[model samples]
Target: MLETSARLLRLLSLLQTRPEWSGPELAERLDVSVRTVRRDVDKLRGLDYPVEVDLGPTGGYRLGAGAALPPLLLDDEEAVAVAVTLQTAAGSGGVGVAGLGEAAVRALVKLERILPSRLRRRVAAVPVSTVMPLRAMPTVDPTALVAVGAACRDRRVLDLDYTAHDGTVTRRRVEPHHLVSWGRRWYLLAHDLGRDDWRTLRLDRLRPRVGPDGLATGPRFVAREVPGGDPAAYVASKVADVRAAFRCRVRVAAPPDVVRERLWTDQARVDDLGDGTSRLHLAADHVDGAVIMLVGLGLEFVVESPDELGEALRALATRCRKAANGTSGGRVGAPAELG
Candidate 1:
């Protein structure tokens, strides 16, 4: 009886991993007769597992879809993979899918309880943490998420009411294309009929209404692969008038690799100048962030056009001189900046 239970478990694991397994293949793997394999398959079916048998020269036994979710049988590597993914999602802020992270943790706890000693240690060693910046106090209804997702999937037009970051609200009609999640934020890529252009919408701010039939839904927006699918650059472009107000162009006397590593999210562009130097072009909303970043790079750089940035740095230098002469608060020549 113990041997039968073990074999049944082994068979269950195999079925879950692969789409189909012939009766002879299962018999060979289990070191049992074809009749024994058939019996075991029956036992699995009796436990409410929908094991479908295909009768043909090329046919085999397959684990078919059931009406409800079934208990998954996972192996060592699969278990570890699941545990690690659960830990990550649980910590990726409460934006993408609400309560998903918490549910994952709960499920992981139950799974860990049944894990062997080595597996348990591995799962426990993986740490999870959430760093949600600027809490987006918008609740996304599950029904709206589902409805819009379906529209995007099936190619449908949707009427939506969206509130901008500055609290200005407007109603828009659009053709849904794709949904993008980037660093605790969700954006819906869609074709705007009113403006006749593609626009990205914040999912949290959307009040989606089902549109009538006959309105054409656009063709799928072919996505260009991006590292991590993060649209940070695109979002930053729409930041504020100040972003376009001043452009800070600086040539760093350092290797391109070093400059790339030092450049932060605010930078508009970074290019290798060759000959062990790099050029950085960035929008400066606040002169302080730009000047501080340049100083932080610790590399010699020439400030090109948009002399306002240079003026800001000069003003900061004057302040430092004043502090050196005991004029400003904090230590002398410290520039009154974060170390």
Candidate 2:
């Protein structure tokens, strides 16, 4: 009886490994009678496993889908990959996905406990999983995020009030399509009703509310493809809109590589001026931030466009001039404290 039970388990494992297997093929592999194979398959079906069967001369049996989660049979490599991925996901904050990560780890531990000694060592050799280091950005309510995500997957439309960078409040109706996560920020790619165009919006900025519940039933919207499928374009566009307020530019006297690496490595567009100098064009709505960036780099640069950058530099130079001359009126030092 015990031997028969073990053979039944091996047969079950084999059936799960493939989509279809003929009665004779399974019987030949298991060295059992074809009648016994049929009996075992019926036993699996009784256990709530959907073992599908075909009749006639080309008769075969296979495993089919069931309502609830079925037991999964994973080979060595497959098992190891699941364990590693779950460990990584635990730290990745996305709505409540962190909880899924935790569950994955617990499940992996259970699987490892039953794994053979060889398999256990292989899974253990994988370094103890650690969360990746990443800057924290804004986080959204998990339930709300999941609800909206479900809508997107179903191709639904949404009505939301989003706070603009200028603090101006506006309500918009949008056809939500895709949710993209870059670095620490989340973006929603949707079509705006009022604007009649596709827009990429910050998920954090959206004041999402329960709406009139509708799908994007008009037409199947195609997602816009950014150049080079660049992941940075969406964030770059957001930054550009904010920077447009301060129309300024600067030329830094340094090699292209050096200037690019130092000042404005992420933001500035560098044009090689040749002869060890590069033109660094910076555009910012707020001069203070731009000024701080340039001065902080401690690089020799010339303000080239908008002239506002030059004006800012002059203002800083004047402050130094006043501080050096204690008379406070372009006169020689006269501070009693300094003397």
Candidate 3:
């Protein structure tokens, strides 16, 4: 009886491995007779596993979804990967997934308790994950992120409740193409059905409305090729196109590649001047942020436009001078000092 029960468990695991398995294949894998395999299939069905069978040359048994989460089969490597990913997610505080970080932590506790000593060692060996560039990006809703990702995977259309950066929320329908991860943020590259244009929707600001967020029944779409054939490149091109009030270009006394390495690696476009110098063209939403980035480059540079940026730089310089001369109440890098 115990042997039969164990074999049944093994059979369940095998069925869950993939969508379909023929009777002969199952018999061969289990080292049992075809009749026995059929009986076992009946037994699994009796247990309410929803094992569906088609008796034909090309037909086979399939495991359908059940109300409860089915038992998962994982080898040592897969187990370790899940553990490490969960740790990273928890560390990232679920990337603003509400209870996501808490869920990850809870899952980690359960997973670690059941993991074998070898797998536990492997999970412990994985180094901490670090978010790149600026980590100050807003948190993303995990449910919404998964929804858009599923839409991309299934080639479905998504209706979104997207909050624009200007603090206006709008209803939008889009054919999601890809979820591009730029630095610590995720952007969905999609064809806006309403606007009849392509847009990079930030996952953080993406949300749902009433019900039925993704509609598979709607018109199926094959994503058109974006420029440069890359979503990140396309998104960057779009961001660069929206140059605002403060437009400043700087001539840095460094190679284009060197300057690019130092600052605005993504925001600024670098032009090689061919004389150990490069010109950086950048646009910003904030003048102070731009000034801080320019001076933070620690390279000699001349501002080329707006004249407004020059005043911002001068004001920063004055503040620094006062801080250095000990004439001001505050010191240099006071923010860093607060930390």
Candidate 4:
């Protein structure tokens, strides 16, 4: 009876190892006859495991989803991976996924209780003190990310109502390939069926329905290899191509490579002059963020155009001068001019 229980555990582990396994394959792996394999499968079913079977040539058994959750059988590497990911997510403090840190911490505590000592030590060793820069980048809905991710994994076509920057709602039928997170945003790299091309979509702007489009959902598509064979790179390339309302051109006393490291490469176009200096061209929704970023660079730069920017800079300088000399007050300051 003890041996049968052990064998049952071994059988469960084998089933969890893959999506499907043939009866002959399971028998060979378990070193038992096919009849015993069937009986063991039945016993597993009795234990509330959704073990599905198929008959005929090339038939197999599949571990389907049950009504209730079962104890996860994770190997050493899988266990370590989960624990580390949870720790990192909990430590990040809702940076990528909105409001997930608290839930992740709770999940982490529960996970640590069931984890082996070695894995517990590994999770404990993960530093929780890392900090992220305060950027105004939009956070994505964790539920939205998970939903889109599931669709991508199942090769299901997604029907979405998306809001564009202009606030227009458009219906999209997309075969989602992968989810790429960068620049504090989640992007879905998918093939747009209506547009007949590949498109990168921001996850926060989508309202998705699980059902497929009438004809588009006819069959599941195999994930196509994206250009450059990197989904993240593809998303970056697409995001870099976006244009804002206000454009700014400036010349900095630094090399293109140095400037590239300090800014978003895709959003800013950096050109190397034959000299040591480089030119930067970028766009912003308003002059506010641009002014702050350029001043924060700590490098000598000249605004090439836009007299309005020079005026704004001169006003900023006047304010700084006043604050430095204790001259700031309720009254208006002098009209400072910029060359």
Best by TM-score: 4
Model 2 C-alpha lDDT per residue in residues 274-329, reported as the tens digit of each score: 78887766665477667877887778877777666677778777766777875366
Model 4, 1-339: lDDT tens per residue?
A: 998898888889998877679988999999999899999999999999989886857569978667777667788888878878877778887656788888888987888888889777876776667467556566777767777887786677888889887889999988999988665678899999999899999898987765432122334677787989999767866776676876789999999778767773245567789699998876666676677777867788999967767777887898789779988863565553332
| lDDT (10s digit) by residue, model 1, range 127-217 | 7666664334444555567667866755667778898867789999887766765444566777687998767777878877653432234
Candidates 1 and 4, the one with greater lDDT:
4
lDDT of model 2, residue 286:
71
Q: Which 10 consecutive residues of model 4 have the lowest summed lDDT?
A: 210-219
Q: After superposing candidate 2 on the true structure, give the runs of residues whose Cα lies further than 4 Å from its correct spot.
A: 1-136, 210-235, 243-339
Q: Tell me each candidate's TM-score.
A: 0.52, 0.44, 0.67, 0.72
Model 1 residue 125 distance off true place after TM-score fit, in angstroms: 5.3
Error of 1 at 322 (Å): 10
C-alpha-based local distance difference test score of model 2? 0.66
Whole-model Cα lDDT of every candidate shown, in order:
0.71, 0.66, 0.77, 0.78
Q: Which stretches of model 3 miss by more than 4 angstroms?
A: 1-66, 129-137, 165-170, 209-220, 240-247, 251-285, 295-302, 314-339
